[model samples]
Target: MTPKLKEDAQRLVIYIGESDRWRGKPLYAAILETLKAEGLAGATVIRGVAGFGAHSHIHTAAILRLSEDLPLIIHVIDTPEKIEHALELVRPMVREGLITLEDVRVVRYTHRYLNPLPADRLVEEVMTREVETLSPEMTVAAAWQKMLETLIKAMPVVDNSGQVLGMVTDEDLLERAGLQQRLSVAERLDKPLLDEEIARLRQSPLRVADVMSKPPITAQAREPLGLAAMRMAKHGIKRLPVLNDQGQLMGVLSRVDILRLLSEKPAMKMTAPLGATQTVRDVMTPVIPAVQQDDELPEIVEKLLESGTHRVIVLDGFGKAIGLISDSDVVARIQPSQRRGVIAALFGDALAPSSSVTAAELMSPGVLTARPETSLVQAARMMMNPKRKWLVVVDEQDKPLGLVDRHILLRALTAG
Candidate 1:
């Protein structure tokens, strides 16, 4: 738990000699390390020009008579409980020194420049309060309806007490049961086919507990947003169920929520030169999947499958991105008869055969583009539109250089 300072705080002052040693190390340094390990708010060490101790021997830093044992004072301020705890651990470390404790008022405390990004913000400030959760006994069909209504790819499974048991994602439904397609593809499906899919799910006896991933990863509402973002990136998850001290679900935190915060703040003015600071080129993934404009539908699907991505960029004869192809675009634009087979092929059910439908016929022409020198915040602002996801970094000739998505930006933001 993080220690907080109230109107009344305790200030601990320790006076020792610079030459004092603790287990072959400086006493002042040892005391500071101990306080830090104990999680005190903070500590500061100051060296005095001249001072006298119990022996009445004065130590001075005068040019003519420089003393080896200069007086040092360590200052620590925090709540009374924390100061008392620290005193117990630090008292034994000092063989001979003067320690004093007093009441003090804290005017203000801040850690503005500690991080390159605005990581000091709290999780509760940005987490989604009205999280859509699933019950353990709920049927798979019921969970699907809730997900479709909220447009959420994943949801937390909880019991009557709202304690999260696990997580259920669209992939869980398709893999655990015989569900035909993902939620996105299912939404694009025809009315009768969608009804049929739901009916198929309703026939199964599987409940949310049967499909949810157990031992859910979670975050605390009081923790820093940066810590939560790091957990998300490390686990390769898009969102986390935020919980309170009692382990009850309070909200949900997603990668978009963090990026949205970045979008609203001013550009972080790092100390590095303008050109030396981070940019699209610093974190983007090069060698992205691409398809030619005249490429057939089968070739485009092959590109998506091989690259393990949901979309592919379509380039013109001059090697410039003209449009983009996504699974949704294919399902929405292609003939109804071929939709089932294409969806199957996309999820690795089978390889989709070649067809006369050209990439030009199914691609969305307005492709989002960026430059190598674009700042991460600028790229984040461009992707705020719900319709845009991928930002293709291009060269002067408008050719592809790399790709930047929410995942990439989130990783960059959490990086030290």
Candidate 2:
């Protein structure tokens, strides 16, 4: 969404000849640039095929006079103050043309007419101030515990002087400390197995500096939020450490923070046209990973493995989503003896044997769903529930159409 212009506005029309020049550049081009540089609401340049000027000389795009100076009209509409400012700046450039002004009504304005992300919004406005930072001297064991307690997947490693040294993530711990699963999955492990994993970390001499990724990518607190979002997307990172002008750590900005900005005022009235508003269908991944409701446990595991995702949507006979089967669900719902084999199969150690058990018996029923036309903000609010990571986009018949997860939603907002 974008801010709308007042209904009472002014339209400035400048009539000029294509042959006219301003400092070796086209007069209309120079004027248009000046108006744009002045921050005018909007402008358009339309070249006429055939027309005549005040001199009464005819100009046409006919074969004989194809290079004749065609009439170009520069159209602009904005607030009264902006339009007046533009007229004052550009009027002097049109030495031999006409300029007209008239009152016009602004029927609508949307992101289609402007930038989707507000350029005026600063990074500090949305960044999390009370960031859970890690010290470079902290041991891997200590850092891991901090991440688990804070539920933060990524944390910036800083020095005693508050200078950012590097970044440590859950993936780094998993790779460097021989962890068997992600932080989320590890949290659900039994006490004995969890203690065994912790003991392995305690035995290692690795510190945050040893495992953290150095030369950290960061954003300035004063930079535009849009630019920071772009930096995250360009680097394919989940979050960035925000720093002040002094080069000291200030805060952190994550994908979740950017997504929350989209729905900051969800209840605010949306005045944009229907086509201008983004919907689930605009960003959802159409290729959904799914399995039949009656699929055997082995088949479900195969689908999960093939999809390279933690969860798979379960569909009924009519291809309607009814439930979901996640890796955690498999470990929690299945018999104790089958858990090891299922986990091993998911890691491609071996394929689980087909059993009479069906997906319907293992899957968590009543999945979250959204329609193709559901607004992006609405989708965000619905996904605010901590347990709802993915939203199954469905048709009117409740059949699966696509999938919308946190990453996809974040990508859409960042793209703005």
Q: Which candidate number has the best lDDT?
A: 1
For candidate 2, give the lDDT of residue 414. 57
Error of 2 at 351 (Å): 3.9
- lDDT by residue (1-416, candidate 2, tens digit) is 22236789999999999999999998988987887667676689998989888999999988888789999999999889888888889878889999999999988544531234454589999999998989988888888878777888789998988999999998888677655666766665567766776777888899899999889999999999888887887787878999999899999988778767765643545466534566888789988999999889888988988998888998999888989888778767777667667767766778885567899999989889988988777887788754478998998899988899888876676554
- The 0-to-1 C-alpha lDDT of every candidate, in the order given, reads 0.84, 0.81
Top-scoring candidate (TM-score): 1
After superposition on all CA atoms, what RMSD does each candidate show versus the true structure?
12.2, 11.5
Worst 10 residues of 2 by lDDT: 109-118
Per-prediction TM-score, please?
0.73, 0.71
TM-score of 1: 0.73
- Estimate, for each residue in 138-241, the C-alpha lDDT of model 1 and write its tens digit: 99999988877788879999889989999999988988977777777777778888787788899999998999998999999999988999999888888899
